[model samples]
Target: MEENNKIFDDEEEELYEHFSLDVDPGQTPMRLDKLLAIHLKKSSRNKIQNAIDSQSVRVNGQVVKSSYKPKPGDRIVVALPKPPREPTEILPENIPLNIVYEDEAVLIVNKDAQMVVHPGFANWDGTLVNALVYHFGQLPTSKNGAIRPGLVHRIDKGTSGLLVIAKTEYAMQHLARQFADHSTERTYYALIWGEPEQDKGTINAKLGRSQKDRRVTEVYEDGGYGREAITHYEVLKRMRYVSLVKCNLETGRTHQIRAHMKYIGHPLFGDATYGGDRILRGNMFSKYKQFVENCFQILPRQALHAKSLGFEHPEKKEWMQFDSELPEDMQTLLEKWEAYVQHV
Candidate 1:
């Protein structure tokens, strides 16, 4: 039994990963760098491309050009250097990042839904790192020696869309000060579960950490480590149950959008924890309840996306603005609701 087990382990170690390569006859001669990026998960396109440019990659026993074409049965050999454990930031992930614009000092990255901006306890990998590491050069780190040196402002774990990050320490400090002074203009698009009786309103409430549940913040009336929170909202489109509204933050607070929306009796769609029961019960929007329920089942949380951001470049003394469109999932839900309303 011991001998069999040893033999099994030996076979697994000796097994070479094998993959077949196929190229179309008419397709212009593709580069070796492109081939490797498409083939290997352990390696990225930029790394392989750099190696080829530096004359490090070999094909069929010869140093070849990046655009070298391979004949049928050609043996391609890549002399890949050992990649660093922690590489520098790279391009915005093709992971559907909605980039508004970019400049030398900073880049506006429109974050996707359900993406954690920086590394934390629950998420170590498969994050923006997997994208930034492959896209840009290594960013400058703080004295603390942690990665993600460019990151300046951070949205919530589940919130989506335009958030700014500093490309340099000077830029980072300046942007941080902007947030401190409440000069940055941030706007969010939310599909709430209820229609506000008024077309526009403000939620002025003091928010503090809930003593019973430290994880959440609540509208504290008494003794609590609270801060002044204010949110202004305007209805863009209205349905029987759900209303699409644009929310502006007067002050940045934890869960400001979720909490303020709920306080106004218009919790965001699919928000289960923060008073989204109206949408969940599938009773309010009776005509499109089935569609809304299907959307809720597909979505992990509330329907909120950061649609626009405008702020001054602290260093450059220039105004910068960014905008992101609603994602397809949310768009589909809106379409269904609109169609249902039209039919009625």
Candidate 2:
């Protein structure tokens, strides 16, 4: 039957094939299934199981189980399967938010620090996505199959800033395309440890994951999973031991400002991960040391805020921009820091 043939063709195309095997001298052999997956870029344990079940994989001209191990000279073949398709899950929640701007196609919200954009391990609820799902039924899915829905771009969990969320598929596509073209205007304010000699400059670096610690990113010289990141910054104000800086993002990379600032010897105040020791040390008060030590508190959180966002509306074809003033906590922190300088 033509339908049966079509199904078989699809299955055959889905299966991986002609995987290579290389074993070290005087070493025990590893499983053929593992080798095949590594070689053919085919992942997912279920897909491997399905391939083994259909007898589409061969180990040295012999059909083998999924657990079969291969020797150094053994030739391996695997049938790669077409990736399975799954519907996107968009759950709703009634989380609090500070919405700055909203139109039919797009929304700009002042994303508070410490809130994730979507769900993951250890953070299933209280995300921006959860709030959006509660407000809107669903989000536009991306062609690249990113897990988070409605998010065109992202700021870090600890970075408070204006974020754009899409309301429709058409808007999502257009906005994503605009971000890809580097037309969106994004700027932030941060308090850093020291002042740079130049008022305006750019930090161009390649970033990648750290091999020693997968959780942290590092500036890689040889380009390991790394991408080019550019951050333009200007000194807004210079204090006795700290400086206020404004940053413009040319390329949006994870921890771009934090990492790049640290790389340039001006880590953000209250940014423990990227070196806020200067802020903590500079503000050392012997009388308050015991209290701060007991509480394990430092600069509340890096004094970073998303000041402005600019973009073209997806449906209206109108240029739009929104701004958010500093929250009370940040304003208070700045006030204390400025007073400390005035006394000296």
Candidate 3:
């Protein structure tokens, strides 16, 4: 065990750790999976082999097979998802989930606006993961002992929407690939301050953490920095002060919809991070301000909802899509805005 030195790197959010090991100078040539099995105590041989089959285990950045022999001085990395979660640190809590769809392979949840998807930092309990641990017995974890068991993707804590949690290792791998390839269909509904110039348009921008505010994401319109993010939006309805919009995600980068909408000068209604909290439109009359304030009181969080999600079934290999009705807060907010628009 002393000969096999593992390197740990930290990342933000639901990240799997890169289980990195430098092959010992005196290392004997053996199958890669076997070597990994020795280092990763919690994992079994079959799970290691499955990881190799999925092209997840790489040798010096090159994907390798289970049978591939690692020579001395070779850097072997089991590329699991980022910043691994310790299973022991997370305790199961009986938090209720609005499960939209569930089969042996996957669980589609309509996560609430206030709920954090997983436990982290200040939000160490009462998360979706805590609920998941309680709801199911032994959901499959990925190889390299990376333990965001079953969770493939996530919506923001304040953004209510659909999330697909994989139940099996195979399903996790399959669904993760779909998201990585940007093949999964994700559509969100947002009530934004200010209407778009056109009814429908595409926002092609690069997104990364803001230089000014590391906590929030920013849009890079010039495209020299950040990862590519595309959002196709259509105006569903336009009030004088705000517009109800539908957004389809082409690439699911962090804060893609939120950042892009803000970049285009129409931040999601009530979003404090990107400057939507103030009255972006409407008259200066106290009556209008009072109405907008009333609307804000109705929906306090960012006015964004993941309305629908679609992906191919991991085992069944058929297209599966899930949709949810807007949660009560957002629905009531829309009604309030509609009435205000009509009268004033």
Candidate 4:
């Protein structure tokens, strides 16, 4: 029972949730999972089923089965792994933002790889949240009132890219719906060791935290355990040992691209979490080793960048898209690889 209420680690906190809802007075009786599917657009049916199987779904504070018929006015609570942390008072910081586009409703900013998106355990300050609070006072918070405010989506600290910020409550709801429905377009570029067999392919797998290591997210191939994740990859450029590829995400699971790439035998270069730090393939000479080390120094973080994002304007109802260039580190890494692959 305690396992069902376990608190998520820092990373999982960004993507997971602890939600509570009161069944509408006019709500029709329905299977727990089926009812939840309507409310949880971001949650896959399999995930809700697994939550029910693990006794993580509760009705009026009592654990229930997936097939249980939810009655009107029943208070339902679901833990996607666990509950959120006690709220922390967010303090503003004068950190600068590279605002790409901004209006009354929304803003887009290109984030640096080193900055955590929001406050969490071990990361209270120097976050994008602090910057947001300083720049734009009093933004909308999540329904649960977790630390996140104004953020409709986030990227990993080690993965730099574009993120959309909601400036108004209505904008928040609008963008949130887009992400939950998988209607938002997000493409990431990554440098990975070894090229995938097919230039264009898709990775369909389930992702959940590894049992042996709670800090790491792992791919679960078999059903009944993890959330569905899909990443469509197209190789953009190939050197001898490494390749640059773009991944279009269908679902935004924690570490979806990193874990999926590792599962498919092509972990991103310099991704210390997924065994990409070590030389996984190609020339084994001592000179090659030194060259690899040099490349690692050029890009200390995972060689992944959020390259583009597309979404509909919440108020205007017009489609909008934004793109970003590779950061200096990733750009230099590729230039070095280009020389080395050509035997320079």
Per-residue lDDT of candidate 1, residues 51-72 (tens digit): 5665545555567887776655
Q: Is candidate 2 or candidate 3 better by lDDT?
A: 3
Superposed on all Cα atoms, the candidates' RMSDs to the truth, in angstroms, are 19.9, 9.5, 10.5, 7.8
Flag regions of model 2 displaced more than 4 Å: 1-71, 74-88, 222-225, 277-299
lDDT of each: 0.68, 0.72, 0.84, 0.87
Candidate 2 structure quality by residue, lDDT tens digits, 255-295: 88888888888888877777674334355777445533432
Per-candidate TM-score against the hidden true structure: 0.66, 0.73, 0.75, 0.78
Worst 10 residues of 2 by lDDT: 1-10
In model 1, the Cα lDDT at residue 4 comes to: 10
Ranked candidates, highest lDDT first: 4, 3, 2, 1
Which of 3 and 4 is the better model by lDDT? 4
Q: Is candidate 3 or 4 superior in TM-score?
A: 4
Return the clash pairs for model 3, or none. Answer: 15-82, 15-83, 16-81, 16-82, 16-83
Model 3, 37-60: lDDT tens digits are 888888777567756766657777
Best-matching candidate per lDDT? 4
In candidate 1, the residue pairs with backbone N, CA or C atoms under 3 Å apart (3 or more residues apart, or in different chains) clash, namely 88-138, 89-136, 90-132, 90-135, 90-136, 91-135, 91-136
C-alpha displacement of 202 in model 1, angstroms?
1.3
Q: How close is candidate 3 to the true structure, as a TM-score?
A: 0.75
State residue 119's C-alpha deviation in candidate 2, in Å: 1.0
